[model samples]
Target: MRKTKWFTFRNFFHRSSLTSSMKPRPVNAYSFVPFSPVAMLDPTILTIGGVVLGIAIIERILERWGVIDLVDQFSKVMRFILPVTFYGALFYFFATFMF
Candidate 1:
């Protein structure tokens, strides 16, 4: 006599009764209200303003602690690095278009 297995490949792959009831429904993309440009820009504007304000406050604090020389040194380094980075990025961007 041949021995029978309880779990076959088909039985193992079959979904239970619980999962079959929770199938996903189709959705329309434009279900919500229409877009507003001002509403979108409000958060972006506030974020930029906050970043600028924070930088200014940090600079003021550093100056108060007599880090003017350090700040000047950093500015000198940034003057060189910024241009090199900008040109390198621009070269890569243009290269992408060419290739």
Candidate 2:
């Protein structure tokens, strides 16, 4: 005997019936409309922002502390830096069009 699974979903009671049962009507429609830009932000943007900031900060701090000796080694970091700037530009295009 499974007891009919309790019928536990929120919508088991119809809205009109819910109105009668509750006396005062709770809500006419859904309350909150989320703001546009924040909603527009996709996962990739957040991930890139976090990763780029973290890497740049670490690189700066390392450079400041005199840890990386060879100035030529900065060439490797510059590779990543250029593409990050390009990614920023593409993201701007996305913001302009898609969002």
Candidate 3:
């Protein structure tokens, strides 16, 4: 009798030929350790964080300066553009790198 696709797939994961030693342990089996403060000071992360904080501060300053029209227009454009750009980049990355 021919096995179904599901049966074949299931059997692949549960093959008796695989020894217990070869099986990977569950994530919970490992103890968790918090990152040291020094290890967390990654330059790339700090640079990205600084850029975001700078943008926020600039936006606040623009708002305080009463450039409502310019700010609103820029915000509206960014609201639409950012998502499209983000999704386009994400799709491109997955299409090229993942598949």
Candidate 4:
């Protein structure tokens, strides 16, 4: 005797649902750490420095490639602006979150 296509499909879904329901539900994995302003200061500075360095490197690459005159000019402007922006943002985060 041949099983009908609909019967096989229905059985597949039913079996899957049964097995899924029998398995234990997953536990929540997320854990939060309490924030410490003093602990964060050094890492925050280092992160800002890293970000500035990365931007400078990318700008240098763009200048080397000579892709667009506008990008080269923008890169030059950003070299000074990016550090200031990152530093300002860091200050803002500390001010808002820590204080």
Counting clashing residue pairs in each candidate, in order, gives: 0, 0, 0, 0
Tell me the tens digit of each residue's lDDT in model 3 across 1-99: 955444477787777754454557667554355434564355654555575566657777889999988778767866786567656655654454421
Q: Score residue 41 of candidate 1 by CA lDDT.
A: 42
lDDT pick, better of 1 and 3: 3
- lDDT string for model 4 (1-99, tens) is 955545477687566453442558889885475677575567666687787788778777877798678677877788788878877967867676743
Please report the candidate that would top lDDT against the real structure: 4
lDDT (10s digit) by residue, model 1, range 1-99: 967757677877783645453569898776364445444345544565565566557666877899999767656765686567656655654454321
User: Candidate 1: where is the Cα deviation over 4 Å?
Assistant: 1-66
Pairs that collide in candidate 4 are none
Computed on alpha carbons, the lDDT of every model, listed in order, comes to 0.60, 0.64, 0.62, 0.71
In model 4, where is the ten-residue run with the lowest total lDDT?
A: 14-23
| Residues 6-35, model 2: lDDT tens digits | 544665654334244335757677537434
What TM-score does structure 2 among the candidates reach?
Answer: 0.41
lDDT of prediction 3: 0.62
